[model samples]
Target: MDEQLNHAPCGFLTLSEDGFILEMNQTLLKILNYSHDSLIGQHVNSILTVPARLFSQFYFFPLVKLEQRVEEMYISLEAGNGEEIPVLINALLRKVNERTVLECIIIPMRKRNEFENELLLAKKETEAALKAKHKAITELETTLKKLEIQKQELLELNQQNQKYKIETQKELELARIIQETSLTDPINNDKVQMEVFYNASGELSGDIYGIYQIDQNRYGIILLDVMGHGISSALITMTLHSLFQRLISAGVPVDLVMKELDSHLHKLFDNNEEARHYSTAIYLLIDTERQKIDYANAGHPPALWQDPNGTQYELSSTAPPLGTFEGVVFKTNTFTYKKGGRLLLYTDGVDPLISNYLAPLVRKTVSLPLFQLKQEILQCLNNEKKVDFKSDDETFILVDLK
Candidate 1:
C-alpha cells in the first residue's frame, strides 16, 4: 500500500488533526513547488493560501470530522513563482492506529482557464459587428423616407398642371361659341339677299362675314379673313367684329367703315414690332332698286357674278389689304346686275380642297343656279382620294336677287 501511494500519478497528502502536514508523496512535493522536508512539518493551510481559520469558523472541519469524508471542494495553491493555480481538493478524515488524520488530493486546472478566456473574446467581437450592422440599417431607413416625400411632391405638381390645362380649354371653347353666334345672324329687311356657310377646322375659326342693313332699300356685306389659324386668328376676327359693329351702328358709310377700321387696328398694334398681323376684306353695298352693286376689295379674291342669262364673271380687286397703308384711296367698282341674278363670295380654303381633282372643273367657268353650283362644288371635292378633313376655316356666301 505504501509503494502504491508513493508511485501514484496525482498528488496526495495527509494532515494531522492539529492541521500540520503529517505525510506527503513525492508528487505532492513537486506539484506544490516544495520539497518533502519543507512541507512535512508545515501546516497544510499554509501551503494552500486559504487560511485554516476559515475552515474552522465555517464548520467545514466539524462536518468533515463527523461525516468522515467531503468531496470536490475547489481551492487555490500558491506556486514558488507566486502564480495562482486552481485545484480540485478532496478531504477524508480517518483513525489509523489511534491517530486521526485528513487525506487530500490535488488536481491542476490550466486548460479550463484557457477555454474561458477565448469565449469572452469571441463574445466581444460578435457584439461590435452587430452594432455596426444596426447603424447601417438605421441610415438606409432615413434615406428611403426622404425619397418617398419627393415622389409625393412630384405627383402633386403633375395633378395641378393637369387641372390648369382643363380649365383653359373650357374657357377657349366658350369664347368660340360666342364668336360663331355673332357672325352667322342674318339681318332682315335688306335690299340684297344673303346666306352664309362656315366650317372651322377646330373649335374656333379665322374666317368671318356678316350682312348689315342700312335701310329698307340699301344693304352692306363684309367678308373678312384674319391671318393665321386657331386661337390667334380667332382673336383677330373677334376684334374686327367688335370694331365694325360699333362703327356701322353709328351710321358710318360703307367705304368710310373700312378706313376707320384700318386706322384703329394700326394704332392698336403699333407696339407689336413683328408686324406679321393684318386682315384682308371685301366690303360691298348693293342698291336693289337701281340694280347696282358698289364694292371695294382689300387684298381679297374677286366676287363672282352670275347674270340671269347664265353669264359668269369675276370682279377684280383694286386696292391692297386693309392696315397695309394709311390714307390709301380704295376704288369702288359699280356693276349693274339683272333683276334675277346671283352672286357668290367665298374664302380661299373652299376651292383649294376641291382643286386636288377638280382643277379643270373649277377653271372652266359655268353659270348655274345657286343650288346646282353648290352641288357641283361638293361633287368635285368628293371625288378626291385623300380628302383632308383637317382643312383651314372655310366660308362661302350666296346671294340671289329676285
Candidate 2:
C-alpha cells in the first residue's frame, strides 16, 4: 500500500493535526516543485497560495477530524515559477497500523477554464455579425418601399394626362359642329335654279355663301373665300355670317352694306399676325321687277350670264378683296337681265375640269341653257378615268325671271 501511494499518477500528501506536512509522495514532490525532505517538515498552509486561515481553522481541521472525509473542495497551490494553479482537493482522516494519518488528492482545473473562455468569445462574434446583417436587410427594405411610391406617382400622372387629352378632343368636335350649323344655303328659293357642291380637304372649310331677299322685288347674293381651311378660317366665316345676317335683317342697302362690311373686316383683322389672312368676295343685287342687275366684285371670278337664245356674257371685276384696305369704295355695274334669261354666279372651285377637258367644250358649245351648261361640267368630271380625282368646293347659283 505504501509503494502504491508513492507511485500514484496524481499528487498525494499527508498532514498532521497542527497543519504540518508529515509525508509526501514522489508525485506530490514533482507536482508541488519541492523535495520530499523539504515538504515533509513544512506546514501545509505555507505551500498553499489561497488564504490558509479559513482552510486550517474552519474546513480542514474541523471537517476532517469530525467527518473523517471531505469531498471535492476547491483550493489553490503555488508552482515553482510562482504562478497560481487552481485545483480540486479531496482530503480524509484515516487509521493505519494503529497510527492516525491525514491524506489529500489535488486535481488541476486549467483545461475547463480555457474551454469556457473560448465558448464565450465565439458567441460574442456570432451575435455581432448577425446584428450587422440585420441592419443591411432593413436598409434594403426601406429603399424598396420608396421606389414603389415613386412608381405609383408616375402612373397617376400618366392617367391625368390621358384625361386632359380626351377633354381637348371633345371640345374640338363641338366647335366643328357649331361652325357647320351656321353655314347659309343660297339655293333655298324656288326662283333660283342653283346647285352647290362643297368638299373640304379636311374636317373644316373656308368657303361660304348666302342668298338674301333685299326688298319686295330685289335679291342679294354673296360668295366669300377666307384665307385658310381649318379652325381659324371656320371662325372667320362664322363671324362674317353673323355680320351679314344682322345687316340684312336691318334692311341695309347692298352698296352701303358692302362698304360697311369691308370696313369692319379690315378693322378687325388689320393687325392679324398671320401673313396670309384676308377674304375675297362677290356681291350682286338684282331688281327682278325692273329686269336689271347691279353687281360688285372684290377679287373674285367673273359672273357668267346665259340669255334665252343661248348667248353667253361674262361680267368682270371692279374692286380689290375685303380686309385689304380701309375706306375702299366698291363700284356696282348694272346690266339688263332681258326677260326670260338666266344669270349665273359661281366660285372658282366650279370649273375644276375647265383647263383639263371643258375648255374646248365651252369654246365650242357656247349656245346652251344654264342647266345644259351645268350638265356639261358634270359630264367632263365623270369622264375622268382616274380613281382619285380630288376637287375643291364648287358652288353655282342661277337666277331666272318668274
Candidate 3:
C-alpha cells in the first residue's frame, strides 16, 4: 500500500499554513524534479511558478481555508529546470493542534491540454466542411430546376406517343374493314353457288381470296395465304389481288397463271437466291360446260369436299409455295360434278386439328347466304371457351354446285 501511495498517478503533498512543504510522495517529487531533501522544508510559494503563486495566494488558498477543500484547480509549478509544468491541483485544509495543514494532489494536465487543442482543431474543420456543403446545396438548386424541365419534357413526349398510337390503331382498323369488304359478288351461276368466310387474327387479314367470272360458263376462284401475318403480309395480299386480275383478265391458264405469278413475285423479292417473302395458294376454274373443277395447289391446305350425301374428300397440296423460284411446276387436279355439293378451300389457320377450340365445320347442303355463313364462322370462334389472340388468320372460300 505504501508503494502504491508513493507511485500514485497524481502528486501528493503536505504543507503547513506558512506555505512550507512538510512531506511529499515520490510522484510529487518527480513532478517537481526534486529529491526529498530539497523539498522537505522549502516554501510552497517558492516551488510554484510566479503566476501560480499569485493565483494560490489570492484565490486558491483563501478558498481552501474557507471551504475546507478546493477541488480541481489548474495551476502551474516551476520544475528543477525552471520549466513550467501544468497540473490539475486539488487541496484540502485540515486542523491539527489548532493549526491548518494542507493536503494536496496535483495531476499532470499536459495530455489533457493537448486533447483540448486537438478538439478545437476538429471543431474548426467540421465548421469548414459544413460551410462547403451549404455552398454546394445553394449551387445545386439551379441544376434541380433544369432536371424538372427535362422531366416535364419527357412526360409531354410520352403523351404525344400515346396519342399517335391511338390514331394509328384507328387507321389500322379502317384498313382491315376495307380489306374485309373487298370480296367479289356471290357467284350464283347456272350450275353453282359460292359462299366465303374470312377472319383475321388482328385488325388486318394476312390471308386473301377472290372469285372472278372468266367467261360465260367458267369462273376463276383463288385462295392466297401470304407466308406471314401482320402488316407486311397484309400488304402482299393487296399486291396479290392486283396481279391476279392482270393475269386472269387476259385469260392466263390456271397452271401458267400460277407459274407466272411465282415468276413475277420472285423478280420482286428474290435476288440470285430465294427471298424471305412468299405465299401459298390454291387456284381453280369452275367449268359449267365440262362439269369439272380444274384446280392447282401450291403449298396450300387441301380443299375439303362434301357430296350431297355428306361424303368428305380432302384435295391435298401438289407443289411448293410461290415466290420461292422462277418457273416452279404446279400439278392440276380435276373433280367431277356433284349435284347439291360444296367445295371448302381455306388456310391452315382454320384447320380444326391445329386449334381444339375451333369446331369442325362440315359444309351443309342447306347453304346459308355468304355473309350469313361468315357470321356463322365468327360466332363459332367467338363462342369458344377462351379467346386465343395468337390464333392465325382463317379464310374459307366455300363453293356449292347447284
Which regions of candidate 2 are displaced past 4 Å? Answer: 1-173, 186-191, 249-251, 352-391
Candidate 2 on 181-289: residue-level lDDT in tens? 6655654344554544454546567777777776677777777777667656665676677787777656666677678778767765544344335777877777778
Q: Model 1: which residue pairs collide?
A: none
**What are the lDDT scores of the predictions, listed in order?**
0.68, 0.66, 0.73
Kindly state the number of residue pairs that clash in model 1: 0
User: Which candidate tops TM-score?
Assistant: 3
lDDT of 1 by residue, 1-402 (tens): 397887587778788886798888877677778877877788765675432233332334655776877655555677666566766667899888898888877666554445445445545544554567655765655555544554465566457447645754764576578678888565433345555678776888888887776666666778888776676567667768878877665556667878876776677466544534677788778878888888888887776776776566776677778778778787767888887677777777766433343334433534455556666766654453155554677787777777
Output the better candidate (1/2) by TM-score: 1
| Clash count per candidate | 0, 0, 0
TM-score, per-candidate, Cα-based = 0.57, 0.52, 0.59
Which ranges of candidate 3 are over 4 A from the true structure?
1-135, 271-275, 325-327, 352-379, 383-389
Against the hidden true structure, what lDDT does model 2 obtain? 0.66
Return the TM-score for candidate 2, rounded to 2 decimals: 0.52
Ranking by lDDT: 3, 1, 2
